[model samples]
Target: MRVFRILAVAFAAITSLSAAPASAQFFLKPADLSGPRVTGNEPGILGQTLTGATQTELDAALVWNLRAALNVAALQCRFAPSLFTREYYNSMLEDHAEELAKAYKTLGGYFERTSENKKQGVTAFDQYGTRLYSGFSTVGGQLSFCQVASDIGKEVLFSPRGSIDRIAHERMYELRRSLLAWGDQAYRGYFALAIPRLPNFNDDCWDESEYRAKRCGDFFASNDSKSG
Candidate 1:
């Protein structure tokens, strides 16, 4: 539970930052999330039908440790035949999901969000009882907390397995794509607002800034000549 403890601390941090900027922030629905080109991960799709799974089956799904926790909390709605319907210790999330999302809303930012994007990372422990990792990161923004719990709600709608639902895994892939797209959009707005003083990319928006005197001098020069 040491790793879980880190998540609890993060929720507290999120609560204190409730005044997080709302002007440039955005919302994500499943529809606006279909276009990202994920190069390195497996597809985890949903809405599939499983004919033979039984309520007593004990096999874990794919990698739904968080969802497992939510199952324990009963915060998530369970399908009649899910492996997660009964409360289990292993499937429980470290914190309450809704509170985590509420706390996250006030704390999201370019600096904070970008810090969590990774193709992948591992969550494991050593035998010495030392805490190796305080958090977890996926391709999306940092999901080390209950922000991902919201997805768990939707993910529970189509359970093919108990702890490791295949469709849920596919939805995770979509979530990574959607979060990336959202991050890109948020950064675009951030740069748009920052253009007055930072007319150049300055290593921040090296690939983003549409107009930059430092990196795109030739492009700007051509525009100036055209105006002349």
Candidate 2:
């Protein structure tokens, strides 16, 4: 109960900023800022995306995603100090929204053709359309900050931006790792059977699903079930 409350408070603080293109895009909150979200976790809740995917397909998808983070976008480009400027970061996303959308569409088409998303129809990962579309947006943001951090010639702990950048990097890196780990668990809460069980951590409840459902509502619901 206490942990759940803390997480709620933490999440509120993290989300003080309103919705935008990158709320859950690149950086995680302070809790996730430190490490991977799925370290030593089990496959508990399968959402709409993983509904049709086999473990193998999900694993491949995981690999594709992680590699995309590492090999594409900012990882591929030189992390020049100049790229760290906030203006560059914000402007590029704004200017290239159309181009990026087109590219993502092409990639989505390619993903649909993959063994995982295309078992029978383009429905396996259909639920994750939004996530898949925007997941990579944050990498560029993180990379921009990382480039700045690199130029500062000190550890991220040295300055506020560096610290934030460092947190963003850790969060992004761990998010990739978590996506990979999630494939192995194969559990879907509320939407599907709850066999494997998710991580027994405070944060997992919030991340797995927040919407209402009959089967797993109490289970997924935070201890503060008293709240509205």
Candidate 3:
């Protein structure tokens, strides 16, 4: 009988362990993300395009887009320092400076080639930089944006130099998608905000602005009881 009881307890422990919940995570996994792979020509992803941009120019745009996204994360997502997006961005600047510089130069050249004059080219390049940063700014989707950017930033840190563009190409689409708000996947529809129902303050429930407890009856009584 003692042996049977011990075996039953062990079986229950194993069953409980097997049924344990999945680990909690704040951010969506990469496989869970939505959006198409960035081909660099998408106006939605790049913000604006230089007319007649070649493949090299397009790749440069993608690299700059990724940089701007991470920069935004560094500035805006600092609230969660543990994510270290700012650190990642700073390190990326040092580690991939050559590739990033080349991308910037390439993009500047594209603008210069497309614009009418040097002055206009400079203006166009400046505007592109401004728009690039602004495009990633978000209030409603801050949580999701920061989370996705944090993941991408860590990945960027691990990525080999000169391969930043490849990471940009692979993740930029998902980064853009993160700008839209996404709720907790596990409890998405299970939760609803509870608003306390206020007591009616109509004339029927009051007499000459004095609350008539008798008129209100059990409503206040129940609430008072709950409070007590």
Winning model by TM-score:
3
> How close is every model to the real structure, measured as TM-score?
0.27, 0.27, 0.70
Report the C-alpha lDDT of model 1 over 38-154, residue by residue, as the tens digit.
Answer: 222233221121123222111122233234333432432232212222222222232233423322232222113333442211111121002101112222332211233334543
Error of 3 at 157 (Å): 0.8
Deviation from native of the Cα of residue 130 in model 1, angstroms: 9.4
Expressed as tens digits, the lDDT of each residue in 1-228 for candidate 2 is: 334533543454355434333432232222122344321122421122444444444434443343233323334334332222332233334433454444445435545765454643355345454455345444423533333222222222133321322333334444433332121112333232122333344553455655333433554455333232
Scored by lDDT, model 2 comes in at 0.36
RMSD in Å for candidate 1, one decimal? 16.4
Higher-scoring candidate on TM-score, 2 or 3: 3
lDDT by residue for model 3 (1-228), tens: 334533543464456455653221354432256566788888677887667999899999999999999999999987766556786787788778999999999999999999999899999999989988998999867877887887788777766777998888898889988887666665544552222334667779877866777767656566665454
| lDDT, residue 107, model 1 | 21
In every candidate, how many clashes are there?
11, 7, 0
State how far residue 120 of model 2 sits from its true place (Å).
7.2
What are the runs in model 2 whose C-alpha is more than 4 Å off?
1-48, 75-133, 139-173, 176-228
Q: Candidate 1 regions off by >4 Å?
A: 1-31, 34-61, 65-149, 157-164, 177-228
The CA lDDT at 81 in model 1 is: 16
